[model samples]
Target chain A: MRQDIIEIRWHGRGGQGAITAAKVVANAVFKAGYKGVVMAPTFGTERRGAPVFTSLKISREKIYDLSPIETPDMVVVLDHTLLEEVDVTHGLKDGGQIILNTPKAIDTYDFGAHKLSISDVTSHALEAGLAPGIVNTGIIGAFAKATGLVSRDLLREAILNEFSVMKPEENARAAALTYDRTVIGGA
Target chain B: MHVIESGNVAAATGVKLARTQVIAAYPITPQTPLTEKLSEFVESGDLPAEYIPVESEHSAMAVCIASSTAGARSFTATSANGLLYMNEQLHWAAGARLPIVMCVANRGVGAPWTVWNDHQDTVSQRDLGWIQLYCADHQQIHDTVLKAFKLAETVSIPVMVCYDGYLLSHTYMPFDVPEQEKVDAFLPGFEPTHFLNPEKPRNFNTVTLPDVRPDLHGNTAPGYMEIRKTLHTDLRAALSEIEKIDGEFGEIFGRGGEPFLEPYCCDDADYVAFCMGSLSYQLRDVVDAMREEGIKVGVMGLKVYRPFPDAAVREALSAFKGVIVLEKALSYGNQGALYADVKSALYSAETRPFVHNYIVGLGGREIKTQHLYDALTESINKEAAVGDEPRWIGLKL
Candidate 1:
C-alpha cells in the first residue's frame, strides 16, 4: 500500500447499501480533487441480510491495483449487529479509525490503540423520514466528521446526486443530521 | 463530462455516444446493469434507439444479427453461461459479416455454477471469429467500446469488448465521458457495402458446394473454403485498422496511443508481467514493490486479444529476460492459453525470453498483490529453470 493512500473497508448486510455508500464517498472524494478513487463490492452471490462488505481507496495518483484491501486505514460498520459475527476490524491498522452505526456509547467498545466514533444512524435515518434502517447515507456523515476526508456539504451533494429519483433531499438531511450527532473518541 | 460511475455505465455511455441504432440483451448477472442502463437510456429518450427485451442470450444475439443485417447499428451484452448459450449465433454473426458489437462481462463458466470474474467465457470463444478487445479499467471500458464499433464496421466482423465481470463491471471509478459531438466526429455512421434490401432480395449464408460455381449472372463466386479464407485474411488485416482508428480516437479525445498493448514502465526493464484485463493493472502494484527492491520489472496489458497481435507481442517482449504470463483462465489440461501464445510468438525470435505461466483468480478467487509479488519474484529467481508446466497461485486444494 502507498503511504499516501487511504483505504477503507465498509461492513454491512447485503441489502443495506454498503456498496452504494462506498460509491457515494468515492464520488464525493473524487469531486474533492483526490483524482484516484475506487469502490468495489465483495464479488459474487450477495444475499439480503447476509453480511457483505465493500472496499474504498483514495489517493492523489491513479490507482492501478484492483486487489482487495488487506489492511484498511478505517473500518465502517453499517450495522453494529454485524460486529458479533464478523470481525470488522480484522486487518485494521494499529491506529486506524472505527466508525459504528450503533446506539451504544463509544466507551462501551474497546478497540485497542485505535480511534472510535459512534452515531445512531438508523435513528437518524428514521428521524429524517427515510425508510427504516436505511442508514447508508447517515453513516457517511459520521465518516466525514471522524476522518475529515470529505466535507459534509460534498457528501450531501453526492447523496443527492446518487438518490436523485428516490428522496434525494431526505437522504442529504439524514447525512447532515448524522454528521452533527456523530461522537468521536480518542485512541 | 467527468463523473464517477461503474464500468457498465461507462460502456453504456459509450454506446449512447456512438448513437447505436438497436440494442437487444437478456438480463444476466454483472452484464444485466449495462443492458438495463441502456434500456433506461432508451426509455428516457436520452438515446433514440430501439431497445429489445429478449427472452434469452441467443435471442438477444439473433436480434443483433437481424438488425445489423438490415444496415442498422446494433449492440448486445452477456456473461458466463449466457455467452455460452449464444455460441452458435456468435459464429453466425461473424461468418455472415454483420458489423455488430457486444460487450462480454467475462465470467467463469460452470457445472459448479459461479457468477464471478474470470476469462474462461471469452477465452473459450477465441476461435469464434469475433474481434476481442479487453479493458483494464473504467476509462478503457468506455474508450474500447467506442473504438470497437468503428473497428467492427471497418472489417465487417462483430466485436466483443470484454472486461473482468465483477472487478471492473461492478467497481465505481472516475472516467471522462467524451462529448457526443466529439464521439460523432471520431466515429461516423455505419454504411455497409452490402446489406439486405427488400427491393432486391438476396440470399445470405446459403448452403454452397465445395467447389467454385457461377451465379445466375454467370459471375464466378467464392466457395465455402474461399469464404472462410477471406474472413481469416480480413481479420488479420483488421489489426492495422485497429491501430489507425485508435490513433484517430486519440487525436480527437486525447486519451489513446497504445492500441494493441498498453505497456507500463517496460522501456527500461528486463522483466515484464503479461496478462489481459484488470490483472495487468493489478500487477502494477507488484511491479512497484519489486522495483523498490532493485528488481527491474514492468507490466504489459494485452488490450486486443483475438487478433493475438503476435508480431507486437514478440517485438515488445523479445528484449526482456523473463515474461511472467498470469491469467484468470486456462486450457484445462494443457496450459494457460496466453502462455502458449506467447511462447509460440517468441519461437522464431533470435533470442527468446523465458516465458512462465501462472494461473490465478479463477472463479472470482481473491488475487492478492503479495501472491503476485511472490510468484514474479520466484520466476525471476529461477529464470529459465522455471519449467514449462503452468503453475497455480493462491491454490488451497
Candidate 2:
C-alpha cells in the first residue's frame, strides 16, 4: 500500500451497480482535482445476486500500479447482507472507515477498531422517486458525507452526468438525501 | 476534453476522430464494448460510417479487407479466440497490403474457457505481418489507435493496436480526447496509391509463377517468392517510417518522443525490467520502490512489438548490468517470446547484459506487487540463479 494513494474496495451484487458507483466516484474525485484515479471491477462471469467487488484508487500523482489492492484504506458496502456473504472487513487497515448502506444503527454491528458510517441509501433512493433498489448513486452521497474526501456538489454533478439520459434529477436528489442522512461513528 | 471513462470509450473516440469509414466486428468480451460504442456513434449519426454486424470474427476481418481495398479507411476490433479465428484473413490483409486498423484487447487463449487479460493472443500472431503496438494506459490506447491508422496507411500495412483486456479495457481512467480538427490535420484523408476503381480496373494479389515473368508491358513482374520478399523487406523498412510518424505525431499531439520504447528511470540505472503492454507500467512502481532501497533499477516498455524493434532494444539494454524480461506469454517449448527476442537482439552487441526471463499473470492470475518485488529482489541478488528456463510467478501447482 503506497502512502500517497488511497485505495477503496466496493462490495455489492452483480446487478447492484457497484461497478457504476466506483466509476462515478472515480470521475468525481478526478474532477475534484485528484490527478490520478482508477476504477476496475472484478473480472469474471458476473451473475445477478452474485457477490462481486471493485476497486478504486485515487492520488495526487499518476498511478502506475494496476495490481489488485490487497490492503485497502477503506471498504464500501452497498448491501448490508454482503457483510455476511463476504468478509467486507478483510484487509481493511486498522481504524479504517467502513461505509455501509444499512438501515440499522451504527452500534448494531461491531467492526473492531474500524470507523463505521451507516446510511439508509435504499430508502433514500425510493423516497426520492427512484425505482426500488437503485441505491448506487445514493451510496456516493454517503461516501462523500462520511469521508469528506469529495464535495456534495461534485458528486451531484457526476451523478447527473452519468445518468443524463435516465432519471438524472431523481438520482441527484437521492444522493442529496443520503448525504444528509449519513451517520458517522467513531472507531 | 478530459474525462474519466472506460478504455473502450477512449479507443472508440480515437476511431471516431480518425473519421474511419467502415467498421465490422463480432462481439467478444473486453472488445465488445469498443465496437458497441462505435455502433452507438454510428446509429446516433455522430460518426458517419458503415457499421456491419458481422456473424463471426472471420467475416469481420473480411469486411475490413474488402472495404479497405476499395479505398475506404476501415476499422475493427476483437479479442483472444476471436483474433485467432481471423488468422487467415489477417495474413491476407497484410499480404494484400490493406491499410486497415484493428484493436486487439489482448486476452488469454482459451482451452479451459477463460476470458481474461494476457498477451498470448497478439504475441502468438507475431509472424502474421501486422504492425503491432502495445499501450500501457487509457491515454496510450487512444493515442496509439489514432497513430495506428496513420502508420498503417503510410506503410500500406495493417496494424494491431493492442492493450491488455479487462486490465485496460474495463478500467475507468482519465484521458484527453484530442480535437477532431487536430486529428484531421495530422491525418489527411485516405488517398491510397492503388485501389479498386471502375475508372482503373486491375486485379490485386493475383496468382503468379514461381519465377520472374513478363507483364503486359514486357517488364519483368515479380513472382510469388519475389512478392513475399518485397512484403518482408517493406515491413522491415516500415520500422523507420514508424519512427518518423511517431516524431511527427509528437510534434502535433505533445505526446511522443519514444516511438518504439518508453523508458522510465533508466538514465543511470544498472538493472532494467523490460516487458510489453500495461505490465511495464506496473513495474514502474516496483522500480521506484526498489530505487528507494539504493537499487539502481528502471523499467522500459516495448511499445512496438512487430518487425521486432531489435535495434532499439539492443541499444537500450546493452549497457545495463542486468535485464529482466517479465511477460505474460511464453513460446511453450522454449521460453518467454520476449525473452528469446531480447536475447537474440543483444547477441551481436559488444557488451551484453545478464538477461533473465519471468512469466507472470497467465490466464488472468492475480499479479501482486509483492510477488513482483520479491522476484526483482531475487533477480538482483542471486544473479547465479539465472538459467535458460523462465521462472513462473504465482504457480500454485
Candidate 3:
C-alpha cells in the first residue's frame, strides 16, 4: 500500500525493537531515493512488555507536519499477541496492508480488509542467535520482500548500519532469511 | 554533502564545525545525545576541544563561564531542570558579556516528572538577557550554529540556539552539511576583546560602582549602570547585525534564515497565527490548508525570541484583523508568555489587532495540524476580551 505518501504503524511491546525497526526502515527508505522520511515512537517514556506503537512516514515529497500519523497505509506487528489486545487496524485505509510475525499459515488468519503478509521473523531471530522476544528488525526483511516498498540490499545495509547487536551478521542473515521465506496472501 | 541527521547530532555537528574550544556538559534526556556525540568527537580527535565531564548542570555552566573568562570559545548544552539549575550563572554569563553559545533542547518543566517537549524551560529564562534563536529544522540548527557564533562574538552577547525536544531532537531529515572550508570562510576565528592573564594582569570588572571609574592606567571606564545600559543597547543593536550576518551567511553558505522572524503568505492575510519552533512548521501547513478552505490564513514564525523582534511582529500582525498567538509553553496564572509579548508589542499600534493567546502541546502532548485549525477557528469565533486569561487548548474537563 506504499504510495506517494505512505504512513506505516508498527505494533510491538516495549523492548521489542519496534522503534529501532521504524528508524531503520525510514533510514533505508531514504537510502533508496525517497528523501523525506520520519519515524517516531509513542510518547510514553518507558515500560517493558507494555502495549506500545511506533509510526513512520516515507514520502517522495517533503513532509512538513511533525504530528504522529493518525491513519496508516500499512501496519507491522512485531508482537503477535497484540492482535487480540488492541485494534491494530484502527484508522487504516480501506485497502491497507498488514505484515505480521506469526507461525500460522497465510490461510489460517482472517485479516479483515487487509492484504496479509506473514513471516516467522521470530524463528529467523532464534536462528540468528537472538533471544526469544524482539523480532523487529528480522520482520523488516519480510516487509521489504512482501510489499516491495523497500530494497532488500538497503534493508540489509540499514540493519547492519543501525543494529549494534553482538553478531550483526546474524541480524543481516535473519533479515535475508525472513525476506525470502515470507508468504503473501489475500491481496 | 547532504546527510540525514537527527536534531541532537545536527547540533553536535555544528559545535564540531565551529571548532568550539571548551564543551562543558551534563547529560539530560533529549539533550544527552548531543553532548554524548560531542564526547565521542572529542575522544576520536575529530573535535579538538576540552570536553569537561561535569558533575551537575550547575557545574557545567560554571565551567563555560570560567573557560569564557579565560578567552576560550565555549559551548554547553542542557535541558529543563538543567537550564533551571543554571539560572544564576545564566545571568552571570550575560552580565559579564561572554559570547558563549548553548543549545537548549527545549523541554517541559517538571513538576509531576515528565521528559517531553515544550518551551516552558527556555521561555522561562527570557528575562536573563541572552540572545535566543529558535530553529524549525536540522538544517536551521546546523546553519544557525555557525551564524550564532559569529553573532555572539560580534555582539559579545551569549546566544541560546533552541529547538523543540524529542520532535526535532529525535526526528531525522536530510540536510546539506556545509563544507568545512566554506564554514571556516564563513565563520572566522574567535577574537576575545578582553581576558584574564597572569603576565599582563589587567583588572576586569572586580567591583564596578554605580558610576564611571578610572582604571590603573588612569583610563576612565563606565561602571555597573553603563554596563547594564550597554547590554540592552547592544542586544537591541544586534537586530540589524542579525539581518546582516544572516545575509552574509546566505551569500556564502547558500542558505540562511531571517534571524528575527519569517513571514509566510502574509501579504494579503486577514487572519494570521503567531508561533515559533517545530510547531511553526506544522502551523505553516495548517495555514495552507485553511487557505484552501478560503480562510485567508497566514503564519509568521518568530525565530528570534530574545531581543524580541517587536517591530517586525508589530508590522506582521498589523495587516491581520485577528492574530492568534499559539505557543507550546504556559505562564500558569497569567497568559502564555508569548501572548503577553505579542500583546505588548502591539499595544501602541494604530490599528491594534485582536490577539488571542492559547497554549497547546505542553509536556509534549500531541498537537496535530487539525488542532491549529481548531485554535484558529475558536479564536476567530470568540470575542476579544482585553484583560482575560489566555485559554488553554486541548485540556480535558
Error of 1 at B3 (Å): 1.3
lDDT tens digits, residue span B1-397, model 3: 7677688989999999998999999999879889999999999999999999999999999999889888999999999999999999999999999999999999998896779999999999998889999998888888888888999999999999999898988877777888889889988888898887897787654788988889778999898988998999999999999999999999998776576777788888888888889887778777887788788878888999998989988877875888888898877778788999998999988998888988888898888677678888878776545555776677767
For model 1, the superposed segments whose C-alpha errors exceed 4 Å read: B383-386
For candidate 2, the docking band is: medium
**Candidate 1 residues A15-128, lDDT tens each?**
999988998999999989899998888887799999999999999888888778889999999999998999999999999999999999888999999889999999999999
Among all candidates shown, the one with the greatest TM-score: 2
Per-residue lDDT over B171-278 for candidate 2, one digit per residue giving the tens place of the 0 to 100 score? 888999988888998999999999999899988878778999988999999888888888889889989999998888888989888989999999999999999999
The docking category that best describes candidate 3 is: acceptable
Better structure of 2 and 3 per lDDT: 2
DockQ of each: 0.80, 0.79, 0.46
- Interface C-alpha root-mean-square deviation, candidates in order: 1.1, 1.1, 3.9
Q: Give the TM-score of candidate 2.
A: 0.98
Residue pairs with backbone atoms closer than 3 Å in model 2 (clashes): none
- Cα lDDT computed for each candidate against the true fold: 0.93, 0.92, 0.86
TM-score order of candidates, top first: 2, 1, 3
Least accurate stretch of 10 residues (summed lDDT) in model 3 chain A?
A1-10
